[model samples]
Target: MNRLFDKSIVLACCIAAALGLAVDARLVAAFCLGVVVASLAEIAQGERARRASEAASYAYIMVAVFAPSFAPFAPLALYDIARRVRREHVWGALGAGAIFVCALVAYAHAGALPARALLLTAILSVAATLLSLRTAQLEREQERMRRTRDELQERALVLEARNRDLADRQDYEVELATLAERARIAREIHDNVGHQLTRASLQAEALRVVHADEPGVAADFTDVKRTVDEALQLVRASVHALNDNATDLSVQLERIVEDARSDGGPQIELEVLAEHAPANIANCFAAILREALSNTMRHTRAQNVIVRCMEHPSFYQLVVSDDGTGAAKTNSRGIAEGMGLGSMRERVEALGGTFTAGPRAGAPGWRVFATVPKQQGDDAR
Candidate 1:
């Protein structure tokens, strides 16, 4: 609109010179000055400037029409008014154009100007108004298209983040279930097979004592007792290995931390209070560890991270902290907005536990802590 208004000023000057050549050059100069003054208001930035410009423009059109020489520039004035003036005030432009026509016709009839010149002036005014409306329509359409493209790009990014969260959750669930099953099987072997082997070894020892005087029988019984003891040792060792593998939370966390450092990620520390923990709690803690590591790497600019898993008599707790500019500034919105941290909170809450995350107190960092109740099932014992 501003560009068209500027161009219209030049066009108006040309039209005034061509039509009013015989009139005093002073009147044409006056019309040019009036248009420039009105254009100043039209091209202004804010609403107040535009409204003041509109009043100035109306004054110019009303006074200019009384003289036949300045009459040709009326349409150019109408064009500027239509483009810059709001719709509610559009009647002002139409009324001004009407008055210009009536005055131009009266002047022409009184021999102030030719009939053909009046016809040309009316046609130019109508054409200019129509052209201004078309330009406004094209500009509105372009703005709408730009907004739609931005919205679609934002939606695509949200969907991609959700898909990744779902994939990670699914993998974590599968791994936890497998670990639980292994722990269960290991318990059954230790309780049933381990107990029977102990009894067999005890009976063989008694037989060796009773047959001590018979060389062949004593030697055979001694060999049986030693073999049973060795078999029992192997079974106990196997059971321990299975249990260790099932709930190796410390080892698992350390590996994750080490891998991150090796890949040029953050400096991380892992601490484990006990060598063994309940499989269910350990599994959940491992998931929490993986997610915390991921969130820190992806979202924070922290240089150092600390991950700790500690087991008590009745509960197990996991804490992941980082020395980054924490999300606590945004409060709940920061922790709840993202899928990764939100899911971690959900997992902890579902297990009847407490989950908390925010800026570390009196420090420049974020802290995530969760404590899950210990379940007294086979794995727990």
Candidate 2:
């Protein structure tokens, strides 16, 4: 709307300039020449230049007042003056009003206009003043609204970031609580149940010493001692498994292989390419190793077993291979005959890991391989 008003004013100036060409051509030429010069000079560069341009515009208005047709352009100057002049300045306000009144008086006297024409001109001029004031007010309101919208958008972004930080903190706290509980359970089992198993094994040894003269009774005492010793080893292994820690992974794997070899199960070979791993990766590696070895011993009368562990920048891997009679194929996974293999697969894949177990191609043996991520921050889900 503001742009349209400016264009209308420019159009009025051109029409007035053309109409003045016939009535009193010499006076009309002087007025048109002044208006053109003032309009051209209005395109000022700086503060000093703008003040000079304003002075020239006022001079052109005084000269153009003689022609009744050039009356519409008078409001353009009044609008500019109203904006720059404060209301408290009485003299400035009166000066602008006097210039507008003089232009109306000169226009009314110069031409043989009717009384109705004079009244109409007065109404139009007053309406132009009100329109200029309204346009300025509208511009201020628009600027205020734009600033309000920008502030709202910035506040929303800040709130979203704060919410994300709160969620991350909550997850961290829950993970800490879970790890603490597991360690506490492992400690209780080692302190209470382990002590009873050790005492029982010692009692059986003393019984065999006391019955040294009787061969049959001594043999029974020897068997009881051996069984107690085996139970103690099993209990220790279980406690170690419960207390899952990253740095303890290599040590636990070694113990598992040693126990199997000493029990006349298989000639086992172990290789660890990387020892350092995150807690989740280390736990998964230990679980897969235990399950695979158990399956090889129970299902296949394997003569030899091989286990390998490797660590990469982002993940850890485990491979267990046994040279024995491979299990027969069924509907589910080849190793799904027992719950251990299925459980191990679920554990590995739960942490964005992969697990596979099957008979080795072109070989009379079975192999189990798995890879788990070093950082499974989201848990099983």
Candidate 3:
């Protein structure tokens, strides 16, 4: 748009100058025609068509040289040639120089034009050419700068995303480390302090038995034994609480899903809604899920598996299902009992939970369902 406006201003100035120099209507018409041809050549698309259009524009300017009065408007075509010559085209530069020489020769031979008028025309033509070349150079520089700015913006966005990912990874690692530290503390307390308290309680019981005949001494020893038992129970509860708090059920589920994915096996979707499940319940469910997934991968040609762990007001539920034809075959061949199904059932029943594994009743797949009541899970813990 800027280039067009510049060309428009140059064309208007040339026409005004030509009119001031007393150019006739015929010369003005020829100059406008040459300008129109040069503009068309500038906008031409293909190589061959552009070259042909340029040739036609040059022909018009050469013919206009005969009228000498058209000299003021000659800068229009020279401007375009100057821009093209800046591309380092040898033929274009030679052609432009030849045309300028011919026009000067014609102007010098025309007896009506003075030396000063000829000199002014030459100066005007050179100024327009140099202006056009500078404009082209500036446009190239602007385009290069624009591309560089866009590349920098893209790189900045990529780096910002990477930084965000790094921050998330750091937080995850910290949480895992914290959980591991808590578990270690709980184990240390149970192994060292718990054993010592149990031993003290047993020693107190032995003293109570040895002094059974002495009523006062036996009573004192019995009281000491009871106190040690209570302390041991409190320590045990504290250790259990620490271990439970350290267990992140959701994180464990996610890890299981990630491991399944890394195996390049069936696509597994796990939805764990049991946010505050007991540690025992969480461990039980995780074990069941791992076994279920293993069985699905090993025995079934399943493309998709879905595992859901949900906590209800009354019970916690775990369901692992797979869309595979192998379920029906396994049921028919009684192979489900041999594929770790017994272990899953025993784990659930030991916690007073119910377990079932078979083909889905109303669906074309296999479903493993287990539910442990909240009361049972708490008692187990």
Q: lDDT of each structure?
A: 0.73, 0.67, 0.79
Per-residue CA lDDT of candidate 2, range 1-381, in tens? Answer: 573564356436444433523456554555465445435444567878766765655655564465554444444454444444546764765675677577677656765434454555456556555665676677778888988888888898898888898896576456556656777888898899899989998999899999999999999999998998999899887877677541355665776776677566788999888665655666678778887887777778678898999887777789998888643433333536468788888888888889888888888788898987766622432
Candidates sorted by lDDT, descending order? 3, 1, 2
For model 3, how many clashes? 0
Poorest 10 consecutive residues of model 1 by lDDT?
328-337
The per-residue C-alpha lDDT of model 2 at residue 278 equals 55
Taking all chains together, the TM-score of candidate 2 against the true structure is 0.49
Query: What TM-score, over all chains together, does every model reach?
Result: 0.56, 0.49, 0.66
Better of 1 and 2 by lDDT: 1
Best candidate per lDDT, number? 3
Off by over 4 Å in 2: 1-69, 83-94, 110-121, 208-381
Candidate 2, position 71, lDDT: 48
State the lDDT of candidate 3 residue by residue for 243-360, as single tens digits.
9989888767777777787566778898989878888888888888888887787777778999888989999999999887763557542675764888899999999999999888
Q: Which residue pairs in candidate 3 collide? A: none
